[model samples]
Target: MVAFALAAVFFLALCLSAREDRRRFRNAVLFGLTFISLSVALLLQLDKVPNWVAYPIVLAVFAVPTLGTLALGVFLIGNGVTMVRKEGRRPANLLSMLAGLGIFGMIALLMVVQMAGSRVLDGIVGTLAVIVAYISFLFLCFLGYAFLYGRIRVRGDVDHVVMLGSGLIGGDRVPPLLASRLRKGQDIYEAQLARGGRPPVLLPSGGKGSDEKVAEARAMADWLIAQGVPAEHITLEDRSTTTEENMLFSREIMTADDPGYRCVVVTNNFHAFRAAMMARKAGVNGQVLGSPTAKYYWPSATIREFVAVFWEHRAVNLGICGLLIALGTAATLTT
Candidate 1:
């Protein structure tokens, strides 16, 4: 009952945090955390037979991949039809269509693996479960870190600042995602200026996309200048097409005179951790700052970011999961 109660409490916490609107990943993980915590609690209360039974039940739960596969199928069919009708099957759209179909193929492969191997591979059934459990744990680690890291704020002196650009709507104007970043960056920039710091160079780093009328960096630079930030203080690095490019290009411009610079990367609050990871990869030694994000977009966006990070270092991630699974399988086998 105590474990159940704690699980319920965490589940509630997850729901509350999900209300941040745009952060779908955080909310989904919160709900997941609640469910797993409850499962862990229930495991503590069960005897051996029940514990054994729980494993199969969890195995059955893996069948949700079918539902995901179905969803993918339907979406791809609809998207393909629309794309074919509207664009006459463009190469890029066709690639997206193929990717969607490829997901269903993966689901099909897993289903076949389960069905054909169910008899003799029953031993490895537990093995698979252990592997999956650890993968879930890997997800949990990222979700936990992302949640906690989102709460941290950069509230002090800084010499250099980078407002990492999110894409804008209609190719020119600041969308809410990018706007939130700029506002946060501006606030930090103003705060520093007020505290007798002359003015930190605000690097708005993004190149213009083919679809966009102007570069995002220039838009951000203009916004800052109008907010009473002096023209000389805002250096626009207007040629980065991606986040890595944004960081690398901005750093190159900022560190043109001095390579060793202390700085903060400003982005949406939900993006702070991934941005920190990116900055670390780019060899930038600075903390990250997140501004307010809309509630709805964050969950899906943050989850996508988390998956990207995990896959970015898949060997390490897979190795850690492998270790955990090995341990769990041995423990289960022994018991």
Candidate 2:
């Protein structure tokens, strides 16, 4: 019953997370499965559940960590291959490939260990493996939830809106990506004023492309001013090519009045978490808000964010994978 209850609760959390934040959906699926598996394993320990009933139920629960890790492993390997080929041997690219391969190797090793053992130690190892798997899954689930909560909470209190830019379409117009960021920023700016908050500053941050006519920052700043934002309320950060620089350089203007500040970052929905991560890295103290995105672009974008997160904490991700394989292998050999 406790097992079922836990599973039910985790499931509910996932459903809510997925519905509200698509970036969380993949993590949510794996998380819910892990929770359900643990719940069943707990149930199997009951005297009321017979070996015949309990063993299979336990087996099903135990399968999630191994299988989930295996799937993630394969994905990493595939992405690694793609990364190496497309990006050459740049250090960053190599790191990505290595991380992906690390997942693949761990999962593959676990499967091999499972295949080789059927003893008492094997059962023990299997149980341990499942625990580790559940832990990793939960961590990812928590990460998604934390980012979501932070995004929502911070946006709700935002008094200043910053739109980080990408390239413009045809070197002249707002692409969907940039437009999403701009619109969300504008909306929040208006909302704050409507609620009697003093007029929020709207900062459009981006530089020009090598072949472009105008800086994205200037273009976006103009767009907002045309929409009735007083020219005085707009700040143009016309010299940042990367997201990090966008926040850093913008922070200069943002803090020109006072070095200490709280502001809201605006980006596409799929990008909110990563953008927030960048904000933290750039030493900008603030939360992130997201604008809507077209459906077709989300999968690739979300995957990119996951990869970025993995890189952001390489030792932790790989260490967890290593521990899972070791525990699973040891328990299998022992039980």
Candidate 3:
């Protein structure tokens, strides 16, 4: 009953938080709370079953996830090889592969320690296990919420469609990644026109890089013009290099024309939630939409984005990690 009640409460809170601000971190927390509560409710029902049946069911649940994790590790490693072969041998491209290797390495180290039967090794592993558990829980939450946030439909109307910039391929040519964002922006612009109102302005946001021949905004604007969007409907915000600057400068342009401008920022699917978070922090009155990305590129890019978010909240994360380490040390001393 308690579990069911908590589930109900969390579900209500999830709905409320989502309604209030889908971009807020509280929505993720509420979603996780609701899921955990419901899971507990389901598990509690197993108390009514015979121990023989319930015990096997419980064991299978744990075993299945362990097997799944191992399988995922293997898949990441293979995908990393494919990324290196097709994409390049850059450090950024190696993250997924490295992560997979790290997972397996940790597992192997634990097994070795167990085999050695050393008290010191056992104590270290125990401490690590607790810390790993907490980090894993947070990772799951981030993955789940990022997926959910991207799936959310940005309906009604928007006054502007802001496309964030990725770097050029050959000094000025639009890369597939940046082209994907432009395509999504064009779709949004057309959708708004079809709804029988003034079409939203398409704002391509990016500054010139040291290596680039022209600004990213200019390249994006040319792409939109070639795609049949009128020159008047497109605006170029060509003086911002970073995503934070993209939002800030775009907001400046929008506010100069209309102070209460509602807009949707566009980026790759993997970056939508993080961009929306940045937009909110930058005081932009808009949400973010995502375009499709290549499957092979998503894991590392997503991991990179997650790392940025973790770093953005590093103070809180470090505080929690400190507490966890303290708890582990206390456990070791007591034992």
lDDT of each: 0.71, 0.70, 0.88
Off by over 4 Å in 2: 1-147, 155-159, 319-335
Q: Is candidate 1 or candidate 3 better by lDDT?
A: 3
Worst 10 residues of 2 by lDDT: 20-29
Query: Model 2 over residues 133-173: C-alpha lDDT tens digits?
Result: 55556546645554554456443445467898888877767
Ranking by lDDT: 3, 1, 2
Across 1-22, the per-residue lDDT of candidate 1 in tens digits comes to 6758889898778757744432
TM-score of 2: 0.61
Q: After superposition on all CA atoms, what RMSD does each candidate show versus the true structure?
A: 9.0, 7.9, 2.1
Per-residue lDDT of 130 in model 2: 71
How well does each candidate superpose onto the true structure, as a TM-score? 0.62, 0.61, 0.94
Q: Largest lDDT belongs to which candidate? A: 3
Span of ten consecutive residues with least summed lDDT in model 3: 56-65
